[model samples]
Target chain A: MNSEETITKASVEDIDRIIHEPARLNIMLYLYVVENADFVYLLHKTGLSKGNLSVHLQKLEANGYLEIMKEFLNRKPHTMVRLTQRGRDAFTAYRESLLNILQ
Target chain B: MKDPLLEQVQNDVATEQQYRDGIPRIAAGFFLIITMLLQMNGNGNTFVMFVPLMPTIIESLRKRFTYPRIGYAKVRDRGSMRKYSLWAVGILLLVGAAVFFINQVSPGTIPQENHQPLLLMWATAIIVVLLGIMVFTSRSNIMATLNAMGVVAIANRFFVLGLHRDALYVVMIAFGAFLLLSGLYSLLSFVKEYPVLTDE
Candidate 1:
C-alpha cells in the first residue's frame, strides 16, 4: 500500500471501536475521571435520555468496559457505574492512539 | 482542534469536583473564624488542636449536605485528601513535640513574644499561593474570587503591619470574614443550582 493508504489503515485499526461512538466515548471520559458515579449523575453530565444511557451502559458492561452495580438508596433503586481496570487501560490506550493518529 | 471533547470533559470533571458543593469552603471558613477568635483571645495554640480534625469535619459536613443534592462521584484525587489529613496530624504532632522538647532542653529558648505581623505575612503568602493554585486548576469564578480576596488580604496585612503592629488581629478577621461570606454565597448558589433529585 502507498504511504497515505497505509497511514489511513493504521489509524482506522488503532481506534478502539467500542469507545469510538460519541455517546460511549463521553461515558468513558466521565467514568475515567471518577471512581464511580450513579446513573443520575451520568445522565446529568451526558445530557442523554435515560433509555439511551441505560442502553449504552449495558453495551459497555457487556464489553467488560464498565461495571454497573444495582443497590437500594433511600428505599429506591439506584444504579452506579464505574470503569473497570481493563476499561481504564483501554481508555488510556485509546487516548494515546487517537493522539498518535492525529499527529 | 486537539481533542476538544477530552478538554471539555476534563474541565467538567474539575468543575464538578471543586464547585459542585461549597461544603469545604464553609467548613474552612468556620475554621478560620474560630482560629482568629482564639488568637484574639490569647488562646491561639489551643485551636491548633483542631487542625487535624478539620478534614474529617469537612467530609462529614459534605456527606450530610452535598451528597443528597448531587449524587456522589468520587473524584480521582479524593483519596489524596485522607493522605493530606494524615500529614496535617503528623505535622501538628511534630510541632508540639518540638515545642515541648525545646522548652525542656533550654528554658526560654523559644520566643514567647507575639510575632503576629510576621506570622500573618507568612500566612498571607501561603494562602495566596494555595488560592492561586486553585484558580489555575479550576478557573472557576468562585476560585477566582477567592484568589482576588487572598491578594487583597495580603495587601491589608501589610497595611495593618505598617500602621499598628498590635492591630494585626484585624487582618485575620477580615480574611476570615471574606472566606465565610464567599462560602455562604457559594453554598446558597449550589443549593439553588442543584435541588435534591428524587430517585425515579
Candidate 2:
C-alpha cells in the first residue's frame, strides 16, 4: 500500500481499539450524548450491576475520560459523572477516524 | 427497590429546581417592595413592609417540594438549569431597574437620616446580582444554591434591621448553621462516592 494508505490504516486501528471495549465504549457514548450522569442513572441506563459499573467507570475515569463527583442524597451515597473536554474531543476524533476508514 | 430515601432525594432535587424556576417572580416581588419602601416617608420602616412578603416567598418555595423533577431523563440529563437561571437573572435586572426608577423619583424618601441601612441594602443587592451572574455562567448547582440563600438572608437581615426588628439575628445564625452542616455533608459524600481512580 502507498504511504498515505499505510498511515490511514494505522490510525483506524487506534480508533477501533479505543471504542472496542463494549463497557467502556458504551460509557463514553452515554457521556458523549448527555452532559452529566450520576452513578445510579448510569447503572440504570447501562443495565450493569453496581460493582461491574464501578470497575469500568474507574477505568474510564483513570484515563481522564470522565470526571466523577460524589455527593450525598438524604445522607446516602451518590456518584455523578461527566465527560471531560479531552474525552469529548477524543470521542469525536475516534468516531471520525473510524468513519474515514469505513468510507 | 422501594427506597423512601431515594424518593426524598428526588423530592429535594425537584424542590430545588422549582425554587430556581420561580426566582424571576420572587425577584419581581422584592423589586416591588423596594419601590414601595422608596415611596414611603419613613424609609427605615421599609423593612417592616417586607415581613408580609416573607410568607409568600416561603410558600412558593414549599410548593416546590410537592412537584419533584428528579430522575427524569429530560431534566436530569441536560444542563437546562443554567438556561433557566440566566432567564431569572434577566428578569431580576429588569425588575431592579424599575425599582431604581422609583427610588430616583422619590428622593429623600429613603431618609438620608440613616443612610447606613440603605447602604447595606444596596450592598446586599449588589452581592445578589453578582451571585446571579455566577449562577448564569457556571455549572456548579450547589454554589448557586448557596449564593441564593445568601441573597435572601442578606435582604431579610437588612430589611428587618431597618424596621428595628432584632429577630433576624436568630434567623441568620440558624441559616449559617444549616449551611455549615450541608457543606460538610456534601464534602464527605463526595469522598465516599467515588474513590480516586489511581491508574491515570
Candidate 3:
C-alpha cells in the first residue's frame, strides 16, 4: 500500500499499543455512555476482576483520561469514575484517527 | 495525573466491544424480518420455509457487504449457521406436529375465520424464536437486526391482515418512520462518542 493508504490504515503496532487491550477500552466506553459509574459498575461492565480493573483504572487515571472520586457510600469506601474533558476530546480524536487508518 | 494514551486505548476498546455486542442482534433481526415477510405471503409449508433461505442470506450478506465495517466480517465460522439451521428445522417440525395434533384433537377449536391469523401468529412466533437463536449464536449487528424486525413487523401487519394495499402502504410508512427515528438515535449516540473526521 502507498503511504496514503498506510496513513489511512491504523498500523498493527498502533492498535496493539493503544486500542487492542480488553479492560481499559471497556472502562472508557462505559464511562462514555454513562456520565459517571461506580467502581462496582465498572467491575461488572468490564468483567474484570477488581484488582485487574483497579490497576487499569489507575493507569488511566494517571494518564489524565479519567477522574476518580473517592467517597463514602453506605459508610463504605466507594470510588466513582468520570471522563475528564481532555479525556473525552482525546477519545473522540483517537476514534476518528483509528477509523481513518482502519477504513 | 491522567494518561491520555491509556484513556484513548480504553475508548477504542469500548467502541469495538459495543460493535461486537451488537452483531448477533443484527443477524437475528435480519432473519426475523425475512421470515416474517415470507410468512406474511401465506405460502410454503412452515416446517422448512426458511431452511433454504438461511444460507443464501448469509452468503449474500457476506459477499455484498464489506467485512468488519458493516458487521459482515464477524461470520467467520459456519458452526453457528449449522446449529441455527438444525434448531430451526427441529422447532419447525415440533410446531408442525403440535399444530397437526391440536387440529386432530379438537377440530372445532380453530374457527375458519381465525385460522389464517392464527397461522400468521404461529409463523411470527417461530421467526421470533429463530431470531433469538441468531442473537445467541451469530455475530450480527444489533442495529441491522432492529431495522429488520421493524421491517418484518410492518410487513406482517399489512400482508397477513389482508388489508387494503393503501393501508399497507400507510402502515409501512409509519414503520419506516419509527425505524428512522430509532436508527438516528443509535447513530447519534455512536457519533457523539466518535465524531466523524473531515480533512479540512
Candidate 4:
C-alpha cells in the first residue's frame, strides 16, 4: 500500500470512535478541564443549539462518559455535566492516539 | 471540518479570562490597603506574612464573582497543579528565608525607617507572581496594564519627588483604590452583560 493509504488507515484506526465524532469530542474535551460545567457554559463553549446540544450530550451520557445532573434553580431547570473517570481515561487515550495527527 | 474541540477549548479559555478579568487589579489594590493597614499597626512582621495568601484571595474572589454569572472549570490538571504546588513550596521557602534574614539581620540588609521600599519589594514580588499565574494558567491579559501600573505606583514611592513616605503611601493608596474600583466596575459590567441565564 502507498504511504498515504497506510497513513490514512493508521490514523482512522487509532481514532476513538466515541470521541472522534465532532460534537461529542468537543463536549468531552471541554469538560475535561472543569469539575463540572453547566448547560449554558457548555452551550457557549460549543456554540451548539439547544436541540443539537441536548442530543450530543445524551449520547455522551449513554456512553457513560458524561454524568448529568438536572436540578431546579429558582423554579427554573438547571443542568450540569461532569466528565466521568471512564470518560477522562477515554479522552487521555484518545489524545495519546492522536499525537501523530496533532504533530 | 474545523477543529471544534480546539475551538471550544479556545473559547473557554477566553471565557475564563473574561470571568477573571479585573481580579488582578483588585488584588493589587487589596495588597496596597493591607500594606498601609499593617504599617499603621506597626507591621511587626505579622501583616507581611499574609502576603503569600494573595493567590488564594484572588482565587476566592474569582470564584465568588464568576459563579454567580458563569460556572467554573478546574482550569489546571493534576500535573499542572503539582507544578504549582512545587512553586508554592519554593515561594514559601524563599519568603521564609527573606523573613528570617530580615528579622535576624535587620539594620544590615534593610535599614530602619524606610518601610516603603520593603513594601515596594513585597508589592512587586506578589504582583509578578500573580501576573505569572495569570499569564500561564488562565491566559488572562486583562490586568496586564493595570499590573504594570501597580508596580509603577509602588515604585513611585521611592522617587525623590519630595514626597514623604506618608504622602507616597497616600498616592499609592489612591491608585490602588482606583484600580480596585475599576475592577469592581468591570465585574459589575460583566454581571450585567452576562446575566445569569442559568441557575447553574
Candidate 5:
C-alpha cells in the first residue's frame, strides 16, 4: 500500500465507533455544548425516543463516555447526564480523525 | 471545508431552550426602563447598584419558570463573553473620557445646562450597547432587535453630531421601549410554546 493509503487507513481506524452512531452522535453533540442535561432535555434536543435514547445512553455509560445520575425529583425518576473527561477527549480525537479522513 | 455538524452545534447552543424563554431580554428591558426612570427622577447613582443583581435575577427567574419547562442545562461560557464584556466596558469608559476631554477642551461646546442630560443619554447608550452584545448570545430574531438597536445608536450619533440636547431623551426612550416590547413578545411566545411539564 502507498503512504497515502496507509494514512487513510490509520485515520479511519481512529474513528470511535461508539460515538460514530447517529443517535448517540446527536446526544454527544448536545451534551458537549452544555455542562449537564436531564434525560428530558436530551430527549427533546436529540429527538430520540425514550427507549432508543436510554439504550444509547447505556452504551455510552458502559463505554465510560457518559456519567449518568439518577434521583427522584417530586416522586418521579429524573436522570441527569454529562460527558466524562474521557468522552470529551475521545470525541475530540474522533472528530479530528474523521475530518482528516474526509479531507 | 466547513463541518456541518459543528455549525449545527453552534446553532443549537445559540438557540438553546434556556435562551429561548426571553428572560435575559426581559431583564434587560426592565433594567433599561428602571435606569431611565431613576435618571429622570434624579436618582441616577442608585441605578448602578442594580447592575450586579441583574444576572442573579435572571438566573432565579429561569430556575422558577424556564427550568421547569425545559429542564436545566448550564451552557458552557464562550471565550467571546469576556471579550464582549471588555469591549462594552471599554466603550463606556471611552465615552466618559471623551466627554470629559471635550468639557476640558471647550466648556462652551456643551452648555452647562445640557451637560447632565447629555451624560445620562450617553450612559443610556452604553447600557443599550452592552445589552445588545449580551443578547447576541441568543441570536434568535436578535438580528431584528440588534438592527433596531443599531438604528437607535446611529440616530443617537447623528444627534450628538448635531449637538441636539433634547433629542437624546427621545432616542433613549425609543430604544428602551423597543427592547421592552421585543422581550414581551418573545416571552409571550415562549410561554405559549412551552408549558411546564408536570411531574411523572
Candidate 6:
C-alpha cells in the first residue's frame, strides 16, 4: 500500500466505531466499572427510556460487546448485563484512542 | 464528544464509590454503642478488641444482602486510603493507650472531662480528613459540607459546652440508633426498589 493509504487506514482504525455511539458508550463505560448491573440500574443511571436502552443494549449484545441474561426476580423478569472480555478490550482501545487523539 | 450524558455516567460512578450504605452505618452505630457500653464499665482495652471487627461484620452483611439486589462496586482508592487509615488508627490508638497507661501509673494523667474531648477531637479530625478525601475523590459537595457540620457538633458538645460522661453515652447511643434505623430503612427501601427478579 502507498504511504498515504497506510496513514488513512490507521486513522480510521483508531476510532472504535462500534462503541462510538453515545448511549452505547455510556452503557459500556458503566458496565466496565460496575462489572455487572441490572437493566433497571442502567436505565436509571443512563437516564434512558426503557425502549431506548433496550435498543442500544441489543446493538452492543449483537456485536458481542456484552452479555445479557434474563432472570426471574419475585416472578418478574430481571435483565442483568455484563461486558464480555471483548467489550472490555474494545473499551480500553477506545480510551487509548481518545487519549491519542487528544495528545 | 463531551456530552451531558457522558458526564452523568461519570458522576454516577463517582457517587457509587462513596455511596453510603444503611446497614454499614447501622453496624457502625452498633459498634459505637457497644464501645460506649464498655466505656460505661471503664473497660478500655476490651473496646479496642471489638472496634476493628465492626467494619468486617458490616461488609459481610452488605455482601450477602444489599449486593445481590442493588449491585456491588467498590471505590478504587488507589492505596491512599490504606495508608491514611492505618496512620489514623495508629495515632488514635497511641493517644488512647498513652492516657490509659498514664491513668494506671498515676490515676489522673488526663482529667476525666478532658479525655472525651480529646477523643472527640481526634475523631473529628479523622472524620474531617477522611470525608475531605472522599469529597476530593468523589467530588461530592455534600461530603464537603457534611464533615464541617460534624466537626462543629463535636466542638460545640465538648469544647464549648462540657458533656458529662453520661451525656456522652446518650449522644453516642442516639447516633448509633440513628444508624440502626437508617439501615433498616435502607433495607426496606432496597427491597422495594429492587425486588428479587429471578433465581436464575
Best by DockQ: 1
Regions of model 5 farther than 4 Å from truth: A1-15, A69-79, A100-103, B1-4, B17-19, B132-171, B195-200
Compared with the true structure, all predictions reach lDDT values of 0.66, 0.52, 0.52, 0.65, 0.71, 0.62
Ranking by lDDT: 5, 1, 4, 6, 2, 3
Which candidate has the highest lDDT of all?
5
DockQ of 5: 0.46
lDDT of 4 by residue, A17-68 (tens): 9899898888887887666778877776677777888999898899999899
**Tens digits of lDDT, candidate 1, B59-151:** 676656666666667665433334444443344356446756876798765344534534433443344334423322344434534543464
What tens digits encode model 3's per-residue C-alpha lDDT throughout B1-200? 13465445444433343333333334444444444454446542563566556546544443332121222112112354447555654655576578668878989654555455445445544554454444333322233334444544664565556665445434544553553455345544644553222110
Q: Model 5, A7-100: lDDT tens per residue?
A: 9998888789999999998888888877788887776677667788899999999999999999997677888899999998887888888889
Best of the candidates, TM-score: 5
Residue B105 lDDT in candidate 5: 92
DockQ order, best first, reads: 1, 5, 4, 6, 2, 3
Ranking by TM-score: 5, 1, 4, 6, 2, 3
Better of 2 and 4 by lDDT: 4
Return the lDDT, model 5, position B193: 82
| Cα DockQ of the candidate 4 complex | 0.37
Residue B94 CA displacement from its true place in model 5, Å: 1.7
Task: State the TM-score of the second chain for every model.
Answer: 0.62, 0.41, 0.40, 0.60, 0.73, 0.62
Docking class of 3: incorrect
lDDT of 6 by residue, B2-108 (tens): 44554566456645433444554566557656766776677744655764575577667765665555454443333443455445445546755775787789976
Candidates 2 and 5 compared: the better one by DockQ is 5
Q: What is the TM-score of each predicted model, taking all chains together?
A: 0.67, 0.39, 0.33, 0.64, 0.77, 0.58
What lDDT is reached at residue A63 by model 2? 82
On residues B1-200, what C-alpha lDDT tens digit does candidate 2 reach at each position? 12354334433444333333344334433543453344343464455455446456544543342122222121233245556666655655665566557668987644554355444344444444444343232333445445554655565456645754233334433443554455345434534543332111
Give candidate 1 regions above 4 Å deviation. Answer: A1-3, A6-15, A72-78, A96-103, B1-8, B77-112, B115-166, B198-200
